[model samples]
Target: MENVCLSEELIKSQVLCAPETKVVIHGEDCSVYKIENETGEGVITRYPVFPGIEILYNDIHMTNGVSHNEAPRPNVVEINHCRVGRFECEFSRGGSIYLGEGDLAVNVMTNITNQTWFPLSHYHGITIAVDIPVAESILKQLSEVMGKGLDFDLSAIRDRLCAKNSCFVMRATDSIQHIFSELYRVPQDLKDGYFKIKVIELFLFLNSPELVNKREERQYFSRKQIDKIKEIRQYLIDNVAQHITLNELSQQFNFPLTSMKLCFKEVYGSTINGYMQAYRVQMAAKFLRETTDCVTEIALKVGYQNSSKFAELFKQFMGQPPSEYRKSFVQ
Candidate 1:
C-alpha cells in the first residue's frame, strides 16, 4: 500500500488540503467522512452548511474505521474565533491513512484496498481561546475609529474564528495596535465588514508567523516578578508531560496560590491549568507533526492514560483526529 501526503491550495481561500491533490489512500473500501456546519458560528441551523464557506471554519476531517470510536475529552475554551471539533467514532481502518481539508469537507483516504468500516461514534466541536474584554475593547476602539454605525465589528471577526490572540498580546501588546490603529483610520462602514479578521491576519503575518521574527516593542513585568515567572515557565518546560497543580506550584514557588495564579495571568495571559493543557497539546502536536508514532504511543508520551482521551483532546485543540493529523504530518 502507498500513502501520499499533500499540502496544496484548494478552491477556497485559506482552506488547505494536505498530502495528495486527489484523495486516494491505501484502500478503495476505506472512506471519506463529512463534517458540516449547518449554521454559522454559535448559530444552529437545521442544515449544516448554511454558514459561509471557509474550508476550515465550516469544514471537517472525514474518517471511518471499525476498531476504536470513542473521542478525547479535553477542555478547549474559545472567546472569539476558531473551533476544536470533537468526534467519537469507533470503527476505523488499522493502516496508513490519507488526509485533506477544504471548503466542503475533510477527506480521508485509506492505504489498504477495499476497506469497509463503521461510524460507531460522533464528533463534537470545541471552541478555541479568545480574550473577550481585550477583543471587545479593541473592537470598540476600532469601531469608534470607524464610527460604529455598521453591524460587523472586530469582536465579530474574533468570534467567528475563536481567535487565539492572548499569547500574541503577551508578547506584542501593539501586535494588535497596527490592526486597531489602521482600522480606526479606515472608512466607518468598512468596520462593519471583516476588518477584524483582516487585522488578525495582519498581526498573525507580521508577528506570529514562524518565517518572520520581527522584533516589536514590548512591556515586561516588574523585575522581581519577572524572575518568578521565568522560574514558572522553566518548570512547565521541564515538566510538560506531568500533571501540574496550581497549589503545588505555588507551594514550591513560595507564593500564595492566589498570587501565583495572578502572576501566571500577568505573565502568560491565561490560567495556569489552561496553559498546562494547551502546552501539553502543543507538545503532543509536535510529536504528531514530527513522528510516525501511533496515537497510543503519542498519548502515553504526553501523559494520557488512554489513546481515545488523547485523540479527543487533540481534536479539541487542533481540529482533526490524530490519525488524520499523522497522515498529513508525515507527508
Candidate 2:
C-alpha cells in the first residue's frame, strides 16, 4: 500500500481536479483541496488510510456548478456516502442519479461524466476511493493475518456493485448508517487507526451476499429533465413571495406536472411544497437575523399572509417562534 500514494495518484488521474481547484498539502499523508467559482466554494479534506486507499470529506457550497474533465480510471472505485444535502452524479452513458441524505453510492471512476453538481447548492459527504491493484495486494496480506474466511476482493466488489460501468446506489440501512455515523464522530487521537478499521468494515459490508442481492435500485433522470427541474427550482426561489401551484409551474415551465413533481422531489430531496415551506422558513430566519422587520412583516415578505400560520410553521421547522428566534440572535 505504501508504494501507491492515493492523494498523488488521484491528482494524477485527474479524478479530483477542476480548473478552479487549488491544492494544499498539509503533510505527507493528508491534503486539502479547494474549488471556488463565481457561485461559491468547496473544500475537500483528504487523508490516506493506506497506500492505495483514502478517505475524503467533501463540504461543498456552490450555486452554479463545478466542471471536471476527468479521465477514465478503470482501476479505481469510489464509494460515496451522502451525510446531508444532495449530490447529482451524471454518467457518460447519459443518465444522472441523485444521492440524497443517508444514501450510499459505489461506482468506478471511469463511469462518471465530466459534469457533477449539487442539487441544493450545498452538500456534505464522505468518499472512500480505492486503487484496485494496490488495495488488493494490501488487503490480501491483511486478510491472511486476519483470517482465511475474510473477503476483501476489490475487483469483485467493484464488479458486483458497479456492473457494466453503472453506479450502484441504495438507501443506507441501519448497519450502513451505524458504520458511517461513527466515522463522522471519530476521536482525533484515533482518527488514522479508526479510518483503517472503518474502511475494511465498509468493504466487508459491501461484499456481503445479502447486500449484493437485495439492494434496491435508484431512479435515473435524463439530463434534459434534470435541467428543467433545476430551472423550476430557481423560478420558485425567485418567486418565493408569490403563491404558485403545480399546475401553474407546469404551464410556466412547459413541463408535465406529474413528471415535474417526481423529478423535482428526486433531484432536490423534497416535494415542492415541503421544499418551499422549509425554504420560506429559512428565508424568514435570515430576515429575522439580518433585518429589524417585525414578525408579521417578515412572514408576509416570505409569502405567508397570515402571521399566525407562519409562526406555526416556523416553530415547526425552527423549533421556536419568530420572536424568540430573533431574540436568540441578539448579542
Candidate 3:
C-alpha cells in the first residue's frame, strides 16, 4: 500500500543500470521486469538484471501469463495477468523458482517446485505481490496476518534445508496454499485481506528453509551431511571466544590450511569470518535484545576485545548502536 506505484524515473534508472554494482558492492545481480498481471495477453522482455525493480504494463496481445512473476529465473515477477500481488525473490547461494512460460498465474504458490540446495543469502524482493492487489479488503487481512510479526524462535533460519525427514516445509506450504486458494476462490469483493500474506508466507518459507541444530529435532540432513556440518558447528562453538585464523584449522584438524579453508568455506557457504561474525552477532543480539548488560560489558563477554570495536561491530551487525538495540528490546 505504501507508494507501490513505480515512477518513470525509477523505471528509467533501472533499465539503464550499471554492470558493476553487484561486483564492486558485493551485491547480487539485478534485472529489469515489466510484466502486467492482466487477463489479456502480451509479450514481456526479459532484461536479466536489476539496479532497481521495474514493472511496466504492456497491453498488446502476446501471452497473458507473462504478466506475473513466478520468476523466469529467480528474477522479479513481471507479467500482465490480473496480477494480484508482487514479491521480490532473491537467493545468495543460487536460488530459483520456476513459473512455467510467458508469465505465471498461480492459484497456488508452487505447482511443481525445483529448489536448489545452497546457502541462499538473504535476497529479499519487496512483496510486490502484496502491493499489486486492488482490494483493500484483502490487503487488510493480509497485513494483519503477516504483520502479526514473525514467529521467530530466535533462529537465523537453518543453514541447510532437508526435504525428506518430516513434513514441516510441505505442511507449511500446503497450509498456506490452502489459505491463498480459499481467498482467491472467493469473489474479489469477499476476498478481503486473504491471499497475499499467505502467498508471501508460502514463498518465504520456501526461501528460508530451516536448519536443524545438533540438539533440536527437525526434518533435514542425511546423517553424512549432518555429521559434516556438525563438525563445523562444534569447531565454532568450541572456539567461540578465540580469534580464529586460517591456519588454526590445520593445527586442530591436521588438514592443510588451504584444504581447511576450502572445506570450511564449502561447507559454510561463506568466508570463515562471515560465519563467525554471524554467529557472534546472533549471540550478541540475544543479550542486546534480552538482558540489561551494558554495551561495553556485553561486547567483551561476547569475545570482542574492545568496547569501541564491539559497539561499531554491533551497529554494523544489528543496524543500530548497541544502546539503541538494547533499548528497543527492553521491556
Using TM-score as the measure, the top candidate is 2
Q: For each candidate, what TM-score against the reference?
A: 0.36, 0.94, 0.35
- Model 3 segments beyond 4 Å from truth? 1-229
Tens digit of per-residue lDDT, candidate 1, span 1-331: 1111111111111112212213322222222222222221111111111011111122334323222222211121121111222221111222211111100011111111222111111222211122333334444554577673432443333322323222111122344334334432446455434444553454244322341233222343343554586588678768766767777888888877876776566444457777677777888888888887778888887777788988998899989988887788564
- List per-prediction Cα lDDT, in the order shown: 0.39, 0.83, 0.38
Going through the candidates in the order shown, the clash numbers are 41, 1, 38
Q: Which stretch of 10 consecutive residues in model 2 shows the poorest summed lDDT?
A: 11-20
Model 3 global lDDT (CA atoms, 0 to 1): 0.38
Q: Could you arrange the candidates by TM-score from highest to lowest? A: 2, 1, 3
TM accuracy, model 2: 0.94
Error of 3 at 245 (Å): 1.8
**Model 2 lDDT per residue over 125-179, tens place:** 8988888887888888888898875656789888888888888888868887988
Predicted model with the maximum lDDT: 2
lDDT of 3 by residue, 131-176 (tens): 1222233434545777854443111221133222111212113433
